[model samples]
Target: MVSVCRLVGLRAVARHAVLVIALGTGLLGAALVALGVVLIFATDVATVYFDWALVALGAATFGVSLLGVFGSKHESPPLLRAYASVLLLLLLSLIGAAAALSSLGEARIDAWMEEHWERIEATTLVVRKDQFEALLADHVAALLTLLACLVLVLTFDLLLVWVLQCSATSRHRRLRGEDVERKPLRASNGAGVELEAVAP
Candidate 1:
């Protein structure tokens, strides 16, 4: 019975790890989407902001994943939980920064539009009003898409963290030593082999 419980606990932990990895991947996707949106609307500024932001987010996610992998391999519940929290925070911060940047971009664009309305109308302004409207519409759509991605990423990360914490708590209860107990093997004589369990 104990062995069976241990096995179930381990399975839960494995599932949690998979979830964490999936959330991490989602965060990366969100970052990429944000970068794409910035490039589309504010190329020059985005080139500078997104380049560093991407690098920071990528490195942080990588580090968190590495920690998680190590924690799983070693069966360290505390370490796993810690790393999961770190990943969650990093994702949240990334989303917050992206939102701030988007707001700043919108403000700047609004200011420019107000200041240059007459000049823009007087100058070539090659693009027609409809075309300009279409472009602006596209930009808004992209921004919204990026925001959605970020929200999804954050939600997934939080879910993963919650699952991991639950799994860790269950595993901690079943912990033994350096190794978890396994199902007994049937011997030729119908005897079962017993094994020692490990702690978390």
Candidate 2:
């Protein structure tokens, strides 16, 4: 009984955690899409493609987050698994992006920065090429750091998926056990009547 109660508590906590995460992710995704649209029209950075990419990624994130929200709310195993599957794909994409960035050379980075600098120069306080290089390096480092953090978070999410599955399985097993116990009681009562009739 204690163990069952503990399992219920853990399941409830995991479900709430999933709900909170889904809500937060959905909000972040919406913000990203909004920012992308704003940048698409406002920025002179010739990064229209990048902005579109952001919108696409954000839309995908929002969709998956909604799936997770609904799955947890309804306790639907298939939806939960589908959410986990999309998350895994997202995680893989991030890893691939990180790997591609890792191979970026200093010259390539400098050229890319120079290409965008003219449009951004007026807004940025930076004047020297060296300053631009430094800022670019910092940005790359920050991106790598953020990716690392995301990887950790996604790993935790995978664990949460397992926990949710286990909770569901255990709950189902408990209900079946109760049904089995009731069946035996009925069978025993029938057997007792039969024995009494045979004794007569």
State each model's C-alpha RMSD to the native: 11.6, 7.7
Candidate 2 per-residue lDDT over residues 31-124, each given as its tens digit: 9899889878987543536678888878988998999899877767788889888878878988888887788766787777779877666553
Residue range 1-200, candidate 1, lDDT tens digits: 35754877645655555556655664675676566565547654333344555656565656666666566555567876786777677677768866765776655766666677656545524445556555765687577677778677656655655566576677677664323345443335335655444322
Candidate 2 regions exceeding 4 Å error are: 1-8, 103-135, 169-200
Q: How much RMSD separates candidate 1 from the native structure?
A: 11.6
What are the TM-scores, per candidate, against the unseen true structure? 0.45, 0.66
Segments of candidate 1 deviating more than 4 angstroms: 1-54, 72-75, 94-140, 176-200
| Best by the TM-score measure | 2
Residue 55, model 1, lDDT: 56
lDDT of 1 at 14: 57
Candidate 2 accuracy as lDDT? 0.76
Worst 10 residues of 2 by lDDT: 191-200
Lowest summed-lDDT stretch of 10 residues in model 1?
A: 177-186
